[model samples]
Target: MRASPPPSSSLGSSCQSSQCQTEGNCMTDLGSIRILYMEDDPGLARLVQKRLKRAGYFVDIAEDGEQGVEQYQAGDYGVLIVDQNMPIYSGLQVLEILSQTGELPPTIMLTGTGSEETAVEAMKLGASDYVVKDAAGGFLDLLPPVIERILKQYRIVEERQRAEEALRESEARFRAVAQTAVDAIISMDSRGRMIFWNHGAGDIFGYDETDVLGRPFTMLLDATCHEKNDPPMSFFEVHGEARMDRGIESLGLRRDGTSVPIELSISNWETISGVFYTVIVRDISERKESEAKLARMAHTDALTGTFNRHYLVGLLEREFQRAKRYNHPIGFLMIDVNRFKQINDQYGHTIGDDVLVAISHELVETLRESDIVVRYGGDEFLIILPETNGETEIARDRLVAAMAASGRFVGLVDFPVTLSIGCAHWDPQDPRTIDRILNDADEEMYKAKRANHEQEGSRAQAPPTFA
Candidate 1:
């Protein structure tokens, strides 16, 4: 027969058959919790087993520590309660074996009185807790609560591990995307010091990680740009606590000290440590060059390389407005190539085209840099002179001299090629529109042409004097 179970205030009296029965429906209500108990003392083991079984726990008993290891491996137990002073292998030795084999369950070590050193050693070997058995066997009362507490703590640890694993996987995915991005991706601190630079940054800026990490981000900005604005600062510096998302077009300096047009976007993120800024940069140099080329093609004449009619009209309107506002004198020269159609008829259109090209070159060389020359139409051109008074005749004389010196018509035609020029000056004192001034110059040009025709076709003719 088993020895009478150790006396307990609650387990023996309060836990009677009616209150804590380990039978059918009652046992099902108290979830199944299998416990493995290893103790060298038969009397103590029998008493503890009876108390646990009555409380609806399924208890498996082992005679010594060595048997405890075999029972633990053979059966599934939610908790292990082993005696520290067991024969052969002790509680600490059993814990070591279980730990080496695999994961151990929630464990509690039972030590004899004044064996605090053994209890400490057991705990260090992976026991969750240890109890000192009293002469009255009072330690048996503490086991249930200890097991519950250990299970709660274990759940907490498992949750924390899962969270850490998820964070690591997220970081890995972000790194993979950043490494393969085509645009330069960079991260910096509030002080504009580089913290991270990806592969695209190296390809765009020609600086490897070793060369740029920990350096100021201003190293990649043109010196002139830095001087024009504030010192290169992160998005956090400008906006303070607010989140920023914006893009700017600026010049980025390369490793070789040359600058490229760059489109930069800034985004800010906040963490417990501080705010960080992410910058995405794209080189726009090729796009800028393409736009400039398209603009030149729109405003310039393909054959003569002079200002096209569209651009010339805009220039004239702008100049007229300026002259009206500033009370400045402006001059206009309307010129026509003499006998151009007759030359084309006599020597084919190719010779006529050559003559027109040569005339355009001569006019460009003769005029001052401030003068505006335009290829207005077939066999016709316009020259605009700003901030001039009483210089119209001087300009006409220069053009005649330039044409005589130029040998463009020598081989193609027997007669000399000359220009009939009409001049008109805007006196701020006179009230006249741009259209009126242009019409007057055009009418005078035809008069010069008629006069030259009447005078046995003089090489060049000048307009009449204006009052």
Candidate 2:
């Protein structure tokens, strides 16, 4: 036979559970978390207090159910753990008193096998969760999950209250700023039902507040919603609420059947009986267009519309890596006009520019799609050949043949323009050093120029232009 716990009384200690000193305890380390623990057994109360203290909890102990009720009524405890039997009252009685408040802290009742009826009564009286004492198997194991569940509920409730208060505060702060937020704030429910649509959202989507509010979110997603075979269940499914900070780019089909790109972030939460989603959406059509323009500019040569030197360098590096990775060879050639400066000076600068343009056109026609013909600089060009024997003399011969076939002449005598060429190959095992390779090609080009000059019996030729 066990004595009944004390009856309910007005709460004592304005601090009550708040007074629990979490110093040197796990509960304290866990952060200002509070608990109310009631037991008629003094020894058991002491044992639990010690354990809980070690776990960093703010634990307030009561010797009986009546004292527990008084402590709880003072409020501020995050959790209430009550024993079913005590001297003046039972856990059920305290639970009954707390149930009437409609806003009591989360409560867990402790009962022995003999007090099973009391446990049922405690539940009816609104105990959140329960634990069995003395005769338990897995009692200690069961304690954590019960406490965690109740505490989680308590925290959820408190957080929601805090969130509402904060949202009000935020709304006040954002009243002026909301007009200028880069993105619109739109929201819906867990079921994809719309709850909010801000002015910015309306402007971006070409919809008015009256048209979007009280409507399903799918109306905004429109056809894009069904694009995926297994479309995401909700915004939360695609981008979790936890990662709401990292925005997602989504395609939104407007009311006019046109598609607009949008960056979206969503958060899902509950308030009272309703669940809501808060989405921040920004129109990214301008951003996308800007990016596209930048990409083209990055890859293009302003003067010739061919790959720029920077892009060409990147392509060469890529090809080099590929050849190295696959144990393959690549061929490249450096070609310079035999007497370009004299052509520039005699023909005038306008004709000189035209000559370069013509040369580029002729080179493009002569090269394979796999080959790159880049204007290395004024009057000098580079050709790259993938999967070729770099040492093959045919590489230079090809350039010579292509230049002759172009039929574009710079001389007044209609003499066919010519290129003096030098070629090199990449060897993965012994690397074709960039400086040495280019230097070798330059040397060969100069050698070819000398040979041409000697063959023509004219050693009085101008040097290559620096450009």
Question: How many clashes show up per model?
Answer: 0, 18
Record all residue pairs in model 1 with backbone atoms less than 3 Å apart, i.e. clashing: none
> What's model 1's lDDT at 443?
89
For residues 207-271, write the lDDT of model 1, one tens digit per residue: 99999988788788787656545655733364343323556777889998888888787787777
Q: List lDDT for all candidates, in order.
A: 0.77, 0.68
Estimate the overall C-alpha local distance difference test score of candidate 2: 0.68
Q: Ten-residue segment with the worst summed lDDT in candidate 1?
A: 1-10
Instruction: Estimate the TM-score of every prediction.
Output: 0.73, 0.49
